[model samples]
Target: MRLIEKVWFNSHPAKYLLVPLLLPLSGLFWLLSTLRRLSFKVGLARSVKLTKPVIVVGNIGVGGNGKTPVVIYLVELSRSLGLTPGVISRGYGGQAPHYPYLVTAESTAVEAGDEPVLIQQRCQVAVAVGSDRIASAELLIAQGCDIIISDDGLQHYRLERDLELIVVDGQRLFGNGLLLPAGPLREGQWRLSTSDLVIYNGKKAKKNANQPLTMTLAATEVANVQSGQCIKLLDFIKLNPSVNAIAGIGAPQRFFDTLKTNKFNVKKQQSFVDHHSFTLADFSDFDDTIALIMTEKDAVKCQGFCQSHWWYLPVDATFSDVDRALLTDKIKALL
Candidate 1:
């Protein structure tokens, strides 16, 4: 059933008879979403207040929109400013959402989920997962955390938030432009107008979408998981001009494209579903392959069994000057 949601949401084509049924059904879903939003807006459903500020980074579209990297960027920037930040996630594919569980160095990708493990590796901050996002936020607060950065809770109204940053996949803005069962939007497109900030992390922004935040891929380097060997983009290109790559992300092609821009000739690019929890069996047949490289998000789930040949590429998000100032200012206000 859960698997069906992923497929159905991604490719819900419209038909005439389905229109009558879907129109009303989408209307109902919209109404419920609207009522839920109104409830929070009007205080019918009170939002939780914490000693620290909660900054939520998420997308309106169902699938990923650079959520993890945005969260990582937030954490990194906050830490440089001397704030002790804690992270919270729904743990989309983990085993412990039934209870509030901490993400630690010892936590496996299976237990803590792939994204959380990646966050733990990148941020080294306190992390936890639970269905009750508010509870997960509170747990982080209890750990002496003063600032909370939620990975993806744009629609989780129950959790409450101080700052709302909507991450948009510029390439696929509001696909089909209809609500669920009709299109990709979880709510109406107008939802973006209300967000405190809109981040366009892709190649371009939507028409007339101003004050837009843009990003360019920074340097790319490969790090050997087992031996801790770090190689520059040039070195990897020099060593092996061509290699096989795998990416289980919202946009696998981005990584592949980045590799190509760096002058490497990639032969095969295997893309899996986002937040993919990799299993050893997935790579069983690809044994002795030294040139397999993937993003850090995918690498976390594949770390323990990562062979000397397997490497992870690290890249950073580069924002424009105006956008960077706006982002930093909004986040700083949380204090």
Candidate 2:
């Protein structure tokens, strides 16, 4: 974890000094965010409502709280319901040639953001990437999509949404419970009350009306990053008991933990900043004989220069039967 992240999520002694120093900036962030949201709410700023309903799957905090997996799950659910769903992303860490670029099979993580490309590849759904989400949504709509899914735009009040789903990291639920700079949240915890649903990405706490849903990421297989050959996770683990693992996601530890849970003897686990652009040199030190494993999100970015021994674990979001029915019913209502 980075120093600031340690200060935010871990019990670092720096928190005693850093929190006080960053509290003023957090207050400023709260003020600006509150004003921006209120402007849309009070009609001071215009919020464009699209022809189709938009389901925003996002989180209040900044780090990876498993929002992308939830978005992917929703896309699959929409397909199961026979509704055409498209995804729109801000394309962070990407420099596209044009505005509202439509993701194609040839799309690279450099052209479109990693998450959008991952979604497009895994779900085979229309994905639009750009800073102007409204424009991106319009592009998706033009492609005959019946519904839209915003990847991580909880604070982008410019585009009006029909439903808001806030994902929370059940393990580190709102570290310090303070706003950005001082902590990890973009908005306060109270924002959860106003959201349509609160989905926990890990072992959920005592269930109540406020947090009725939980999601688990289930990993079943590992695929060769270069050849696209698939193998059962256990089969691969049995052959290679000790391996190297790396993750470039919002919460790298979560990916590491998942590997550990699956009984992979992780010899060397490395964590990189989220959406890190990987180069061939990044893995120069890793032993080639031992398999190198990574999260699918990081795998998407490494495919261009990946080695034969490199593999990626793909995880799917799973819910209990009751929660699945509840979610299905809620989505059906949207139709």
List the global CA lDDT of all models.
Answer: 0.78, 0.91
In model 1, how many backbone clashes occur? Answer: 0
Tell me how far the alpha carbon of residue 264 in candidate 1 is from the true structure, in angstroms, after superposition. 2.4
Candidate 2: residue 48 lDDT (0-100) = 94
Clash number for each model: 0, 0
Error of 1 at 174 (Å): 2.0
Worst 10 contiguous positions by lDDT, candidate 2: 203-212
The model with the greatest TM-score is: 2
Top candidate, metric lDDT: 2
